[model samples]
Target: MLWTITIACLLLAGLIFRQSFRKRNEEIEMAGDAGLAILEFGRAFPGEAIRAVISTANGRTVFLRLHDGKAGCMNAHGHHYSCHLIEPGMVHVTGAGPKRLNVKFSNAAFEGGMFEFRDEKEAAEVSLWLLGSFMPGLAAQNPRIVGQPG
Candidate 1:
Protein backbone atom coordinates (compact mmCIF):
# COMPACT_ATOMS: atom_id res chain seq x y z
CA MET A 1 0.00 0.00 0.00
CA LEU A 2 2.81 2.43 0.75
CA TRP A 3 4.49 1.61 -2.57
CA THR A 4 1.22 2.28 -4.41
CA ILE A 5 0.87 5.67 -2.61
CA THR A 6 4.42 6.60 -3.54
CA ILE A 7 3.79 5.72 -7.17
CA ALA A 8 0.63 7.83 -7.20
CA CYS A 9 2.49 10.79 -5.78
CA LEU A 10 5.21 10.39 -8.39
CA LEU A 11 2.63 10.35 -11.14
CA LEU A 12 1.05 13.52 -9.82
CA ALA A 13 4.41 15.22 -9.66
CA GLY A 14 5.20 14.21 -13.21
CA LEU A 15 1.93 15.64 -14.44
CA ILE A 16 2.57 18.91 -12.68
CA PHE A 17 6.06 19.11 -14.10
CA ARG A 18 4.79 18.47 -17.60
CA GLN A 19 2.11 21.11 -17.29
CA SER A 20 4.59 23.66 -16.01
CA PHE A 21 7.00 22.92 -18.81
CA ARG A 22 4.27 23.32 -21.41
CA LYS A 23 3.20 26.65 -19.96
CA ARG A 24 6.76 27.93 -19.98
CA ASN A 25 7.21 26.89 -23.60
CA GLU A 26 4.06 28.71 -24.56
CA GLU A 27 5.31 31.90 -22.93
CA ILE A 28 8.67 31.61 -24.65
CA GLU A 29 6.98 31.13 -27.99
CA MET A 30 4.82 34.18 -27.41
CA ALA A 31 7.86 36.28 -26.56
CA GLY A 32 9.69 35.04 -29.62
CA ASP A 33 6.75 35.92 -31.80
CA ALA A 34 6.54 39.36 -30.21
CA GLY A 35 10.21 39.91 -30.90
CA LEU A 36 9.69 38.94 -34.52
CA ALA A 37 6.75 41.30 -34.76
CA ILE A 38 8.94 44.08 -33.41
CA LEU A 39 11.52 43.33 -36.07
CA GLU A 40 8.90 43.37 -38.84
CA PHE A 41 8.01 46.88 -37.65
CA GLY A 42 11.42 47.80 -39.15
CA ARG A 43 13.54 48.40 -36.07
CA ALA A 44 16.69 46.51 -35.23
CA PHE A 45 16.42 42.89 -34.11
CA PRO A 46 15.04 42.63 -30.55
CA GLY A 47 18.00 40.41 -29.58
CA GLU A 48 16.30 38.30 -26.88
CA ALA A 49 15.09 41.14 -24.68
CA ILE A 50 11.38 41.91 -24.46
CA ARG A 51 10.98 44.44 -21.71
CA ALA A 52 7.22 44.58 -21.32
CA VAL A 53 3.89 43.75 -22.96
CA ILE A 54 0.73 45.77 -22.37
CA SER A 55 -2.73 44.62 -23.37
CA THR A 56 -5.15 47.10 -24.90
CA ALA A 57 -8.83 47.48 -24.11
CA ASN A 58 -9.57 46.72 -27.75
CA GLY A 59 -7.80 43.34 -27.57
CA ARG A 60 -4.45 44.35 -29.02
CA THR A 61 -1.01 43.97 -27.46
CA VAL A 62 1.62 46.68 -27.35
CA PHE A 63 5.21 45.64 -26.85
CA LEU A 64 7.66 48.28 -25.63
CA ARG A 65 11.38 47.89 -25.22
CA LEU A 66 14.84 49.28 -25.94
CA HIS A 67 17.33 47.73 -28.30
CA ASP A 68 20.78 49.03 -27.45
CA GLY A 69 19.19 52.36 -26.35
CA LYS A 70 16.76 52.85 -29.25
CA ALA A 71 13.10 52.39 -28.38
CA GLY A 72 10.79 50.07 -30.31
CA CYS A 73 7.04 49.62 -30.40
CA MET A 74 5.11 46.64 -31.75
CA ASN A 75 1.34 46.69 -31.71
CA ALA A 76 0.56 43.01 -32.19
CA HIS A 77 -2.54 41.13 -33.20
CA GLY A 78 -2.01 37.38 -33.08
CA HIS A 79 0.97 36.63 -35.34
CA HIS A 80 0.83 39.95 -37.20
CA TYR A 81 1.83 43.34 -35.81
CA SER A 82 2.28 47.04 -36.58
CA CYS A 83 5.64 48.28 -35.38
CA HIS A 84 7.80 51.39 -35.39
CA LEU A 85 10.57 53.22 -33.64
CA ILE A 86 9.54 55.61 -30.87
CA GLU A 87 11.14 59.02 -31.22
CA PRO A 88 10.84 62.22 -29.24
CA GLY A 89 8.25 64.64 -30.58
CA MET A 90 7.06 61.64 -32.56
CA VAL A 91 4.94 60.31 -29.71
CA HIS A 92 2.15 62.15 -27.95
CA VAL A 93 -0.18 61.26 -25.12
CA THR A 94 -3.70 61.74 -26.35
CA GLY A 95 -5.62 60.43 -23.37
CA ALA A 96 -5.59 58.22 -20.25
CA GLY A 97 -7.23 54.94 -19.28
CA PRO A 98 -8.63 53.67 -15.98
CA LYS A 99 -5.55 51.51 -15.86
CA ARG A 100 -4.32 52.20 -19.35
CA LEU A 101 -2.99 54.90 -21.67
CA ASN A 102 -3.76 56.18 -25.14
CA VAL A 103 -1.12 57.61 -27.43
CA LYS A 104 -0.61 58.92 -30.94
CA PHE A 105 2.55 59.12 -32.95
CA SER A 106 3.94 61.46 -35.58
CA ASN A 107 5.54 58.58 -37.42
CA ALA A 108 3.91 57.95 -40.75
CA ALA A 109 4.64 54.25 -40.49
CA PHE A 110 2.06 53.73 -37.78
CA GLU A 111 -1.16 53.85 -39.81
CA GLY A 112 -3.79 54.62 -37.15
CA GLY A 113 -1.39 56.94 -35.33
CA MET A 114 -2.51 55.59 -31.96
CA PHE A 115 -1.89 52.77 -29.49
CA GLU A 116 -3.30 51.79 -26.09
CA PHE A 117 -2.05 50.00 -23.01
CA ARG A 118 -4.08 48.19 -20.38
CA ASP A 119 -1.79 48.96 -17.45
CA GLU A 120 -1.59 52.68 -16.72
CA LYS A 121 1.68 52.36 -14.88
CA GLU A 122 3.22 50.44 -17.77
CA ALA A 123 1.87 53.01 -20.17
CA ALA A 124 3.47 55.80 -18.22
CA GLU A 125 6.73 53.97 -17.79
CA VAL A 126 7.04 52.99 -21.44
CA SER A 127 6.17 56.46 -22.68
CA LEU A 128 8.61 58.10 -20.32
CA TRP A 129 11.30 55.60 -21.16
CA LEU A 130 10.92 56.19 -24.86
CA LEU A 131 10.94 59.95 -24.45
CA GLY A 132 13.80 60.01 -21.95
CA SER A 133 15.86 57.73 -24.16
CA PHE A 134 15.75 60.34 -26.88
CA MET A 135 14.92 63.88 -25.74
CA PRO A 136 15.99 63.56 -22.07
CA GLY A 137 13.96 66.28 -20.28
CA LEU A 138 10.82 66.01 -22.38
CA ALA A 139 9.60 62.87 -20.63
CA ALA A 140 9.65 64.67 -17.28
CA GLN A 141 7.68 67.55 -18.75
CA ASN A 142 4.97 65.35 -20.16
CA PRO A 143 1.81 65.64 -18.04
CA ARG A 144 0.53 62.15 -18.73
CA ILE A 145 1.00 59.96 -15.71
CA VAL A 146 -0.64 56.56 -15.60
CA GLY A 147 -3.44 56.20 -12.98
CA GLN A 148 -3.44 59.96 -12.48
CA PRO A 149 -6.16 62.39 -13.46
CA GLY A 150 -5.15 63.60 -16.90
Candidate 2:
Protein backbone atom coordinates (compact mmCIF):
# COMPACT_ATOMS: atom_id res chain seq x y z
CA MET A 1 0.00 0.00 0.00
CA LEU A 2 2.81 2.44 0.88
CA TRP A 3 4.64 1.74 -2.39
CA THR A 4 1.47 2.20 -4.41
CA ILE A 5 0.76 5.54 -2.75
CA THR A 6 4.34 6.67 -3.33
CA ILE A 7 4.21 5.70 -6.98
CA ALA A 8 0.90 7.47 -7.49
CA CYS A 9 2.20 10.60 -5.80
CA LEU A 10 5.33 10.59 -7.95
CA LEU A 11 3.24 10.26 -11.10
CA LEU A 12 1.03 13.14 -10.03
CA ALA A 13 4.05 15.32 -9.31
CA GLY A 14 5.49 14.61 -12.71
CA LEU A 15 2.18 15.45 -14.35
CA ILE A 16 2.01 18.72 -12.48
CA PHE A 17 5.54 19.62 -13.53
CA ARG A 18 4.73 18.88 -17.15
CA GLN A 19 1.69 21.10 -16.97
CA SER A 20 3.77 23.95 -15.55
CA PHE A 21 6.29 23.68 -18.32
CA ARG A 22 3.55 23.60 -20.91
CA LYS A 23 1.97 26.76 -19.53
CA ARG A 24 5.32 28.55 -19.59
CA ASN A 25 5.88 27.55 -23.17
CA GLU A 26 2.46 28.80 -24.16
CA GLU A 27 3.14 32.16 -22.54
CA ILE A 28 6.45 32.53 -24.34
CA GLU A 29 4.89 31.59 -27.65
CA MET A 30 2.10 34.10 -27.22
CA ALA A 31 4.53 36.87 -26.35
CA GLY A 32 6.79 36.09 -29.27
CA ASP A 33 3.92 36.04 -31.71
CA ALA A 34 2.50 39.24 -30.29
CA GLY A 35 5.84 40.98 -30.53
CA LEU A 36 6.36 39.90 -34.09
CA ALA A 37 2.88 40.95 -35.13
CA ILE A 38 3.32 44.37 -33.57
CA LEU A 39 6.72 44.78 -35.09
CA GLU A 40 5.53 43.84 -38.52
CA PHE A 41 2.22 45.65 -38.39
CA GLY A 42 3.65 48.73 -36.68
CA ARG A 43 7.04 49.11 -38.33
CA ALA A 44 6.07 52.56 -39.57
CA PHE A 45 6.78 54.03 -36.14
CA PRO A 46 9.80 56.26 -36.20
CA GLY A 47 12.21 56.78 -33.29
CA GLU A 48 10.64 54.37 -30.78
CA ALA A 49 7.36 52.74 -29.89
CA ILE A 50 5.25 54.14 -27.06
CA ARG A 51 2.32 52.95 -24.95
CA ALA A 52 -1.30 54.17 -24.52
CA VAL A 53 -3.53 54.20 -21.50
CA ILE A 54 -7.27 53.53 -21.06
CA SER A 55 -9.46 54.00 -17.99
CA THR A 56 -12.06 51.34 -17.34
CA ALA A 57 -15.49 52.16 -15.95
CA ASN A 58 -14.58 50.70 -12.57
CA GLY A 59 -11.69 53.14 -12.40
CA ARG A 60 -9.40 50.22 -13.00
CA THR A 61 -7.00 51.63 -15.52
CA VAL A 62 -6.06 48.72 -17.71
CA PHE A 63 -2.57 49.73 -18.76
CA LEU A 64 -2.93 50.42 -22.49
CA ARG A 65 0.39 52.11 -22.82
CA LEU A 66 2.21 49.09 -24.18
CA HIS A 67 0.22 49.02 -27.41
CA ASP A 68 2.26 52.14 -28.21
CA GLY A 69 3.72 54.06 -25.31
CA LYS A 70 6.17 53.49 -22.51
CA ALA A 71 5.27 50.96 -19.79
CA GLY A 72 2.72 49.29 -22.08
CA CYS A 73 0.81 46.33 -20.76
CA MET A 74 -0.54 43.21 -22.45
CA ASN A 75 -3.35 41.07 -21.17
CA ALA A 76 -1.98 37.94 -19.50
CA HIS A 77 -4.22 35.90 -21.81
CA GLY A 78 -3.97 38.24 -24.83
CA HIS A 79 -7.67 39.05 -24.71
CA HIS A 80 -8.38 42.80 -24.69
CA TYR A 81 -5.44 45.24 -24.68
CA SER A 82 -4.30 48.62 -25.94
CA CYS A 83 -1.32 51.02 -25.88
CA HIS A 84 -0.13 54.38 -27.21
CA LEU A 85 2.97 56.23 -28.42
CA ILE A 86 3.85 59.88 -28.99
CA GLU A 87 5.63 60.94 -32.13
CA PRO A 88 7.22 64.28 -32.89
CA GLY A 89 4.63 66.75 -34.04
CA MET A 90 4.92 69.36 -36.80
CA VAL A 91 5.42 72.37 -34.55
CA HIS A 92 8.49 71.58 -32.48
CA VAL A 93 8.36 73.74 -29.40
CA THR A 94 6.63 73.79 -26.07
CA GLY A 95 3.08 74.96 -26.84
CA ALA A 96 4.26 76.47 -30.11
CA GLY A 97 1.24 74.95 -31.85
CA PRO A 98 0.16 71.32 -31.63
CA LYS A 99 3.32 70.79 -29.58
CA ARG A 100 3.02 67.11 -28.69
CA LEU A 101 1.22 64.31 -30.45
CA ASN A 102 -0.73 61.76 -28.51
CA VAL A 103 -1.98 58.72 -30.46
CA LYS A 104 -4.21 56.33 -28.57
CA PHE A 105 -5.24 52.77 -29.51
CA SER A 106 -6.67 49.46 -28.32
CA ASN A 107 -6.28 45.96 -29.68
CA ALA A 108 -9.24 43.79 -30.60
CA ALA A 109 -10.40 41.83 -27.60
CA PHE A 110 -9.90 38.19 -28.43
CA GLU A 111 -11.66 35.20 -26.96
CA GLY A 112 -9.33 32.78 -25.24
CA GLY A 113 -6.21 32.98 -27.40
CA MET A 114 -8.02 34.30 -30.43
CA PHE A 115 -7.50 38.03 -30.89
CA GLU A 116 -10.19 40.46 -32.02
CA PHE A 117 -9.89 43.40 -34.38
CA ARG A 118 -12.90 45.67 -33.86
CA ASP A 119 -11.82 47.93 -36.64
CA GLU A 120 -8.31 47.17 -37.70
CA LYS A 121 -9.29 48.40 -41.13
CA GLU A 122 -10.47 51.71 -39.70
CA ALA A 123 -7.55 51.79 -37.33
CA ALA A 124 -5.24 51.14 -40.20
CA GLU A 125 -6.74 54.08 -42.02
CA VAL A 126 -6.04 56.37 -39.10
CA SER A 127 -2.66 54.84 -38.51
CA LEU A 128 -1.72 55.72 -42.04
CA TRP A 129 -2.93 59.30 -41.77
CA LEU A 130 -0.89 59.94 -38.66
CA LEU A 131 2.12 58.03 -39.85
CA GLY A 132 2.04 60.00 -43.07
CA SER A 133 1.98 63.23 -41.10
CA PHE A 134 4.94 62.32 -38.91
CA MET A 135 6.75 60.07 -41.38
CA PRO A 136 5.49 60.81 -44.84
CA GLY A 137 8.11 59.16 -46.98
CA LEU A 138 8.49 56.06 -44.90
CA ALA A 139 4.79 55.84 -44.14
CA ALA A 140 4.00 56.14 -47.80
CA GLN A 141 6.48 53.47 -48.69
CA ASN A 142 5.69 51.09 -45.85
CA PRO A 143 2.67 48.81 -46.23
CA ARG A 144 1.23 49.76 -42.87
CA ILE A 145 -1.03 52.54 -44.14
CA VAL A 146 -4.26 52.41 -46.12
CA GLY A 147 -3.00 54.07 -49.29
CA GLN A 148 -0.42 51.37 -49.37
CA PRO A 149 -3.10 49.06 -47.88
CA GLY A 150 -1.34 48.93 -44.53
Candidate 3:
Protein backbone atom coordinates (compact mmCIF):
# COMPACT_ATOMS: atom_id res chain seq x y z
CA MET A 1 0.00 0.00 0.00
CA LEU A 2 2.85 2.43 0.89
CA TRP A 3 4.65 1.71 -2.41
CA THR A 4 1.51 2.37 -4.45
CA ILE A 5 0.78 5.65 -2.67
CA THR A 6 4.34 6.89 -3.21
CA ILE A 7 4.26 6.05 -6.91
CA ALA A 8 0.93 7.83 -7.39
CA CYS A 9 2.23 10.99 -5.68
CA LEU A 10 5.37 10.95 -7.84
CA LEU A 11 3.32 10.55 -10.97
CA LEU A 12 1.05 13.43 -10.03
CA ALA A 13 4.02 15.67 -9.32
CA GLY A 14 5.62 14.76 -12.64
CA LEU A 15 2.42 15.57 -14.49
CA ILE A 16 2.13 18.94 -12.79
CA PHE A 17 5.74 19.77 -13.57
CA ARG A 18 5.33 18.79 -17.19
CA GLN A 19 2.24 20.97 -17.57
CA SER A 20 4.00 24.00 -16.12
CA PHE A 21 7.01 23.46 -18.40
CA ARG A 22 4.76 23.15 -21.42
CA LYS A 23 2.97 26.38 -20.58
CA ARG A 24 6.26 28.27 -20.32
CA ASN A 25 7.53 26.81 -23.58
CA GLU A 26 4.33 27.86 -25.30
CA GLU A 27 4.79 31.44 -24.14
CA ILE A 28 8.38 31.48 -25.41
CA GLU A 29 7.36 30.08 -28.76
CA MET A 30 4.53 32.56 -29.12
CA ALA A 31 6.81 35.43 -28.26
CA GLY A 32 9.26 34.43 -31.00
CA ASP A 33 6.60 34.45 -33.71
CA ALA A 34 6.16 37.96 -35.18
CA GLY A 35 2.90 37.02 -36.85
CA LEU A 36 1.37 35.93 -33.56
CA ALA A 37 2.53 39.11 -31.91
CA ILE A 38 1.00 41.20 -34.65
CA LEU A 39 -2.22 39.24 -34.46
CA GLU A 40 -2.48 39.76 -30.73
CA PHE A 41 -1.78 43.46 -31.05
CA GLY A 42 -4.33 43.79 -33.79
CA ARG A 43 -6.90 42.02 -31.70
CA ALA A 44 -6.20 44.39 -28.86
CA PHE A 45 -6.35 47.49 -31.08
CA PRO A 46 -8.27 46.75 -34.22
CA GLY A 47 -8.17 50.26 -35.60
CA GLU A 48 -4.43 50.57 -35.78
CA ALA A 49 -2.74 49.67 -39.08
CA ILE A 50 0.76 48.33 -38.73
CA ARG A 51 3.34 49.26 -41.35
CA ALA A 52 6.38 47.44 -40.03
CA VAL A 53 7.28 45.06 -37.20
CA ILE A 54 10.59 44.76 -35.40
CA SER A 55 11.13 41.79 -33.15
CA THR A 56 13.82 41.93 -30.55
CA ALA A 57 16.70 39.49 -30.35
CA ASN A 58 15.43 37.98 -27.11
CA GLY A 59 12.03 37.33 -28.72
CA ARG A 60 10.17 38.88 -25.81
CA THR A 61 9.17 42.20 -27.38
CA VAL A 62 7.87 43.38 -30.77
CA PHE A 63 7.95 46.99 -31.90
CA LEU A 64 5.50 48.22 -34.49
CA ARG A 65 5.39 51.16 -36.85
CA LEU A 66 1.90 52.28 -37.64
CA HIS A 67 0.72 53.59 -41.00
CA ASP A 68 -0.43 56.83 -39.46
CA GLY A 69 2.97 57.84 -38.19
CA LYS A 70 2.64 56.20 -34.81
CA ALA A 71 4.61 53.67 -32.85
CA GLY A 72 3.53 50.74 -30.75
CA CYS A 73 4.93 47.77 -28.89
CA MET A 74 3.78 44.35 -27.73
CA ASN A 75 5.46 42.78 -24.72
CA ALA A 76 4.93 39.21 -23.73
CA HIS A 77 3.56 38.80 -20.24
CA GLY A 78 3.11 35.14 -19.43
CA HIS A 79 0.48 33.73 -21.83
CA HIS A 80 -0.80 37.12 -23.01
CA TYR A 81 0.74 40.21 -24.55
CA SER A 82 0.55 43.76 -23.20
CA CYS A 83 0.04 45.97 -26.24
CA HIS A 84 0.49 49.72 -26.05
CA LEU A 85 0.25 52.36 -28.74
CA ILE A 86 3.05 54.79 -28.09
CA GLU A 87 1.95 58.39 -28.27
CA PRO A 88 4.00 61.50 -28.52
CA GLY A 89 5.97 62.27 -25.34
CA MET A 90 5.04 58.89 -23.88
CA VAL A 91 8.39 57.24 -24.37
CA HIS A 92 12.06 58.07 -24.28
CA VAL A 93 14.75 56.01 -26.00
CA THR A 94 18.53 55.99 -25.85
CA GLY A 95 21.02 53.82 -27.61
CA ALA A 96 22.75 51.27 -25.43
CA GLY A 97 24.90 49.95 -28.28
CA PRO A 98 24.89 49.65 -32.02
CA LYS A 99 22.03 47.19 -31.88
CA ARG A 100 20.56 47.79 -28.42
CA LEU A 101 18.36 50.50 -26.89
CA ASN A 102 17.28 51.50 -23.41
CA VAL A 103 13.57 52.40 -23.46
CA LYS A 104 11.75 54.30 -20.74
CA PHE A 105 8.02 54.75 -20.61
CA SER A 106 6.04 57.50 -18.90
CA ASN A 107 3.31 55.13 -17.87
CA ALA A 108 4.09 53.41 -14.59
CA ALA A 109 2.24 50.26 -15.61
CA PHE A 110 4.52 49.67 -18.59
CA GLU A 111 7.89 48.38 -17.58
CA GLY A 112 10.86 49.63 -19.56
CA GLY A 113 14.04 47.75 -20.18
CA MET A 114 16.90 47.17 -22.58
CA PHE A 115 15.78 46.12 -26.06
CA GLU A 116 18.28 44.49 -28.40
CA PHE A 117 17.29 44.52 -32.05
CA ARG A 118 18.50 42.28 -34.86
CA ASP A 119 20.84 44.89 -36.32
CA GLU A 120 21.97 48.51 -36.05
CA LYS A 121 19.52 49.71 -38.70
CA GLU A 122 16.54 48.15 -36.97
CA ALA A 123 17.60 49.60 -33.66
CA ALA A 124 18.04 53.01 -35.24
CA GLU A 125 14.70 52.72 -36.99
CA VAL A 126 12.84 51.92 -33.79
CA SER A 127 14.59 54.76 -32.06
CA LEU A 128 13.40 57.13 -34.74
CA TRP A 129 9.88 55.84 -34.37
CA LEU A 130 9.98 56.34 -30.62
CA LEU A 131 11.35 59.85 -31.07
CA GLY A 132 8.44 60.75 -33.38
CA SER A 133 10.80 61.65 -36.20
CA PHE A 134 10.38 58.65 -38.47
CA MET A 135 8.06 59.35 -41.39
CA PRO A 136 9.48 57.54 -44.35
CA GLY A 137 7.00 57.71 -47.22
CA LEU A 138 5.07 60.50 -45.60
CA ALA A 139 8.07 62.79 -45.63
CA ALA A 140 8.41 62.64 -49.39
CA GLN A 141 4.75 63.48 -49.83
CA ASN A 142 4.89 66.54 -47.59
CA PRO A 143 8.29 68.16 -47.91
CA ARG A 144 7.03 71.39 -46.36
CA ILE A 145 6.27 69.68 -43.04
CA VAL A 146 9.59 67.87 -42.93
CA GLY A 147 11.40 68.42 -39.62
CA GLN A 148 8.23 69.95 -38.18
CA PRO A 149 7.00 68.51 -34.90
CA GLY A 150 3.63 66.84 -34.79
> In model 2, where is the ten-residue run with the lowest total lDDT?
91-100
**Candidate 1's residue-wise lDDT over 40-127, tens digit each?**
6544454535545444445455556553334666655555666666666676654455554456666677644445555677667666
Where does candidate 3 stray beyond 4 Å? 1-25, 133-150
Q: Give me candidate 2's TM-score against the actual structure.
A: 0.33
Q: Per-candidate TM vs. native?
A: 0.48, 0.33, 0.73
Candidate 3: lDDT of 99? 99
lDDT at position 55, candidate 3: 89
lDDT per residue, candidate 3, 5-99, as tens digits?
99999999999999999988887798799889889999999998898899898888999988766788989977689998886677878889999
Candidate 1 wrong stretches, greater than 4 Å: 1-59, 67-69, 112-116, 133-150
For this target, which candidate reaches the highest TM-score against the unseen true structure? 3
Q: Report the poorest 10 consecutive residues by lDDT, candidate 1.
A: 139-148
Q: Write the per-residue lDDT of candidate 2 for residues 1-150, one digit (tens) a residue.
A: 999999999999999999999987865565445444345325533444433333222221222323221232233435223333324243111111121223433233321122222334433333333444454345436665423354
The alpha-carbon RMSD values of the candidates against the true structure, listed in the order shown, are 9.7, 13.9, 4.7
Q: For each candidate, what is the lDDT?
A: 0.57, 0.38, 0.84
